[model samples]
Target: MARPNSSPKASISPQKKNSSSPREADFDIQQELSRLQEVIYESFHIPVSRWTIIDEDKVLEQLEFIGTKIPEAIRKALQVLEQKQEILANAEAYAQRIIQQAQEEAAEILDESGIIQQAQHEANQIRQQVQSECEAIQAQTMAEIEQQRQMANGEVEQIYRKSVSEAQQIQEGADEYADAVLTRLEQELGEMLGVVRNGRQQLYNHSAQRQTNNSGKQLSEG
Candidate 1:
């Protein structure tokens, strides 16, 4: 003989039967709520602000599903809600902490930016001061070098002029000495010429007298 059709309850899976049990009804409520909170936390936050953007429709869907499952659960949601004030207080404290931390971080970043700008400004001032000092030193060095060069040139010119004057004086003295020696030699040569002329005239006179005497003697004897 053919078997009769079984009831739907008899066809239910063991997993389905366990899910309706008192241990973990359908799913863990805390776990689901945690997932929801995680979803909200993962939302996009605005920069420099604690504002977050969430998906309204998706969040509502998850909440509605969680609410539907609450009645099926054996007062688990009631137990969770029984600590509402404590949960809200903890949430408020957590939000305040996050806001305070964000504000402190923003202030730190602003302070760092200010410090960097201040450092740059001081660096520029130091650079300008160093450049000015270097320029002044260079100008002073150039002036000192120019003054030394002028002094050296003046000394060299003075030495050259003194040497030229000394040389001229020596040349004039040598010319005067040479003229005096030449005058003395001319006088000595003229005196020797006069002595030689006088000796020749005396010899000529003596020879004439001797010849005349000889002629007279010859006549007297004849």
Candidate 2:
């Protein structure tokens, strides 16, 4: 037997649904772009994207990490600045000390230079005085030496003249004494010769008288 004819719509739901306009998908693109970077970061560790919607507790933890690191970086920068200030202060003090030392040394050099100049001037004055005195004494000494030489020359000439006169007188006296002795010897020799001649004449006269008497006696005998 054939079944009674059935409608195609019998298995479908019996309630009628109203259809006017389909609802459109509402999306915030700016918000999605802002969370894109966070989504990439979370995907590295958690394997979840912010586009998939994250939990409130995870976002709070990321904000706390950034806050703590900022204060620590600021503290380190302040410490470096303080150290540089101390180094600059020390350099300034050293420069001042060097300048003071140079000024004091310059003053001392000027004082010593003045003292040396004064001493040189005094030495020049004393040297001039001594030179004048020496010249005067030299002149006096030359005059005394000349006077003594003249007196000695005069005494020597007088002594030479007296010695020559005494020698001449002695020579004359010797010649006169020799002449007187020769005269006395010649007179004594003449007197002795005259006495011998008279004796011989007397003997001759006696012999002649004796011969004459003999001749007379012979004539008488004849």
All candidates' TM-scores? Answer: 0.26, 0.28
1-222 in candidate 1: lDDT tens per residue?
Answer: 122222222322222223436534345555556556655655666565546677777678778877776554423422332333333334334434443453454344334233334333433443354345435534553453354335444443333324334334534543453344334433532443343345446666878888999999999999
lDDT by residue (tens digit), candidate 2, 54-76: 44455555445434443443333
> Could you tell me how far off, in angstroms, the CA of residue 164 lies in candidate 1 after the best superposition?
2.2
RMSD of each: 53.8, 69.2
Segments of candidate 1 deviating more than 4 angstroms: 1-159
Q: Tell me, by lDDT, which candidate is best.
A: 1
lDDT of each prediction vs. the true structure?
0.46, 0.37
- lDDT of the structure predicted as candidate 1: 0.46
**How many clashing residue pairs appear in each of the predictions shown?**
0, 0
Candidate 2 residue spans exceeding 4 A from truth: 1-40, 44-50, 113-222
